[model samples]
Target: MPTISGAGFVVTTLNKILAIAGVAIVLGGVALGFRSVSAGGTVCGSAFQPAAGITPMSCDNALNGAGTLVTIVISAGVLCLIAAAAVKVVRDKVNA
Candidate 1:
């Protein structure tokens, strides 16, 4: 069996970390999105419109912000996963 050494070991470790982090981040984003939708719906009614006396547009802006944040988090997680895969491919090609 071939053994990983030096930079190869570091790369392998980093790849594993990245993959795990990506999965975690993706899950977190999904959770956050669900929470936001549910909470926003409750607070702003079915259509995300605030009640008559509440501050105008605040709820809408918050919901939009949450959506943007979720998108960014999920995109970052996917990029991390892709980077990890790319690293593995490159490392294998180099070793081969």
Candidate 2:
């Protein structure tokens, strides 16, 4: 029988919260991006072309959005793994 310590529990909980927050932020950003695209709003346009009636977006803009989402998901997953690892470590330590 192992007893969990206060510090370990708190750290694990905080890490889980941070992971959730990161996921939420990523989802929110993606939703905003979809809204922008649907509304014909350019996020990273070259010069905001309204005369030619053609919005110009560099490959970088698409890359940025994808990269951001990927980064967020990775960060969230890492944080969750860290939290799980911390819980395991604490349990092992307490048991030992």
Candidate 3:
């Protein structure tokens, strides 16, 4: 059986951990988006409703900001997953 050096093992573990965290973050972001839409709809009425002074300014801002935040969080999670994958490829090549 081949043995990995301590540092290599640590790096591999960290990469796996990062991948797990990325997945968790992505799921959390998705949940947040769903919750925001449901809660926002309940509070602000249907989005299909006319926008002429029907929805409060605060509700509009909150909904918009929530969307932006979800985008940012999901993007970050994707980046993390990509980074972990890249690292694994590089590590494999180096060990090969």
Candidate 4:
């Protein structure tokens, strides 16, 4: 059986953790968005709402769509995973 080095295992584990966190962040953001719409508000306060008419439905009306904070969060999560993978790749290349 091939044995993995401690450093190699640590890096792989870190990358996997980052990827998992990114996925969690994305899913949490989506859940939050749905909760916001259902509750007619958001935890982000007025920030995620429109410039005016900052009412209960503001978060729902704005963030429930694709072009809103939810999308940004999901994109960020995907980017985070991509960055982690890139880092792992770079590290592996350097080690090799």
Model 1 Cα RMSD, 1 decimal: 4.8
- Clashes (backbone N, CA, C under 3 Å), per candidate, total 0, 0, 0, 0
Residue-level lDDT for 8 in candidate 2? 65
> What's the lDDT for candidate 3?
0.73
Instruction: Give the range where candidate 3 is weakest over 10 consecutive residues by summed lDDT.
Output: 44-53
Task: Report the C-alpha lDDT of model 4 over 1-96, residue by residue, as the tens digit.
Answer: 756789878888888888898989888766655543323433423323433444545455444553466778888888888978897898779778
Number of the candidate with higher lDDT, 1 or 2: 1
| Cα lDDT tens digits for candidate 2, 1-96 | 755588867766765676676567556555544432212343442211122343445344554555566566656656666666676677568657
Give the lowest summed-lDDT range of ten residues in model 4.
38-47
lDDT of 3 by residue, 3-85 (tens): 98998998899789889989998987887676533334545433233234444664776567677778888898998899889
Cα RMSDs of all predictions?
4.8, 7.0, 4.4, 6.5
C-alpha local distance difference test of each model: 0.75, 0.53, 0.73, 0.66
Mind sharing the TM-score for model 4?
Answer: 0.56
